[model samples]
Target: MASLSLRQVIKRYRTGKTELQVIHGVNAEIADGEFVVIVGPSGCGKSTLLRMVAGLEEISGGEIAIGPRVVNQLEPAERDIAMVFQNYALYPHMSVFDNMAYGLKIAKVPKDEIRTRVDKAAKILELGHLLERKPRELSGGQRQRVAMGRAIVRQPQIFLFDEPLSNLDAKLRAQTRLEIQKLHRELGITSLFVTHDQVEAMTLAQRMIVMNAGHMEQFGTPEEVYNRPATTFVASFIGSPPMNLLHHAPGNRPGQILGIRPEHLDVASDGWPVQVETVELLGAERLVHARLGDEALIVRLHEGEGAPAVGSTLTVRPRQDRLHAFDATTGQRL
Candidate 1:
């Protein structure tokens, strides 16, 4: 296992006469054996940054290192990193054993050693019984597992995944997520994952790097990122329905915005008057969509609490300690 570091990395695409900057000076330090997930919306450069570390994309500027070696110029093979792609990228004609052994064979490893590595990896990924089947014969989850086994057999110092769970069904995705978590625990190799899904980032990452339009917004543990977001982007990006940020110009703190999470909002007999527009029952969650002042707000209450009826006027107040303040112009937390 190895620590990974990227210092002020940038990626630019030459478009006819214009040079477009994709990743703008991303700096991150990942410790050995830590799972770090880089998350953002589509077109936010999360995958671009991962590919830079994999040497699949050229770095526009700055340095990337795996362990102690600066791999800005090193070939992907020499970098000791294995990557699993979103599409699985399995060869339809090759059997699982062949797919898993392909990498070791390319490295000119002895046949016996390749077999041992493939067998071990297959067992760990729960693909031992499907070794004889081709990708086309395997289920989507199995195919994805084979892709993971292919990477695992390499036993690289770092594992890189770019939304590897995106292609699966909901049930399969959850199941595969558990498997990946179990594998990471067993191996404890330094890993960097790229995804647009906040839930995936939260569950997989020991710490997360939240990126926005070509910049790092927040880098913290899942709890830290959720509970103490450093920026407005992070507060909205990490949660499911997102935080309810009202445009309230606090009398003392003029021009600053206050953010209150949906769960932290309390609707009682007293507070700011809110007119409920709709109440959505989401199994365990009841979302009361309301208008507070001039802005629309959503309050998430427990299903057992029984949400307010549409058009009902209620008082809403947020827990003072849970309130987040941000500089409106900069979007930075206060």
Candidate 2:
């Protein structure tokens, strides 16, 4: 495995004299064997950035390097990277073993070495029993695993995953995520994963790049991004209920927005007075949706705590240490 670097990377599309820049200058350093995920909402250019790294998309400016070589001019095949696409892209007629062996075959690897490599990958992916089965015969998760196994056999210096779990059901997605984690642990290949899913980004990434409107908002561990978001967008986008940004929160300065998470606020005898609008029971916890001077906020209540009745006025206090402050105009952390 080798390190990957993106220095002032930019991508632009030109039509006649009209030029549309999609990816702004993005810079990042991914260490060897580190799994970094590029995550954002759709149209945020996360996938485009990953494609640039994969050599599928040409860079309009700046440099991309894999290890010691600058790969801006390199073809995808010459980048020493294996890509796992969203659609699986498996050959229906080819069995699992044959599908995984096709690249080596094209490279003219010896038959015994091909067998050894394919066998090893199959064992790692727990697809040994399905080696003879065609893609059509396998389940969606199994097909994805087969795709991963195909990448494993090549043993590329880096792995690029482009929303590979999008097609799976919720349960299968969770299962496949575990499988991917195990695969990464076993292979230790440098991986760049691109996805719009925050949960996937949080759980799968060693370090995550949070992108917004073609800009890199933040690049840090999940905990760092979640706990100490660099921008209001990062604060609001990374969580389940999202961070609450109060424009006119009590004790807030004129041009500042107060931010707090649902779980970080507690029902108290004295604090911000809010009229309960709704309550949602989520088994182990409850979400209290309330209105505070036309501003909405959610307070998380753990099990054993009574859910407040709708239309009732209750006071919720945000944990002092957990509060976040941002500039209202810039939406940037203070």
Q: Each prediction's TM-score against the native?
A: 0.97, 0.99
For model 2, the stretches where C-alpha displacement exceeds 4 angstroms are: none
lDDT of each: 0.90, 0.94
Error of 1 at 171 (Å): 1.0
Residues 1-334, candidate 1, lDDT per residue (tens digit)?
A: 9999989999999989999998889888999999999999998999989999999999999999999999999888789999999999987788989999998888899999999999998889888899998889988999899999999999999999999999999899889989999999999999999999899899888999999988999889999999999998998899988998767623327767789888888877766788899988889988888887788888888857876778998787778889899888888999
Error of 1 at 300 (Å): 1.0
Task: In candidate 2, list every pair of residues with a backbone clash.
Answer: none
Clashing pairs in 1: none
TM-score between model 1 and native: 0.97
Highest-TM-score candidate: 2
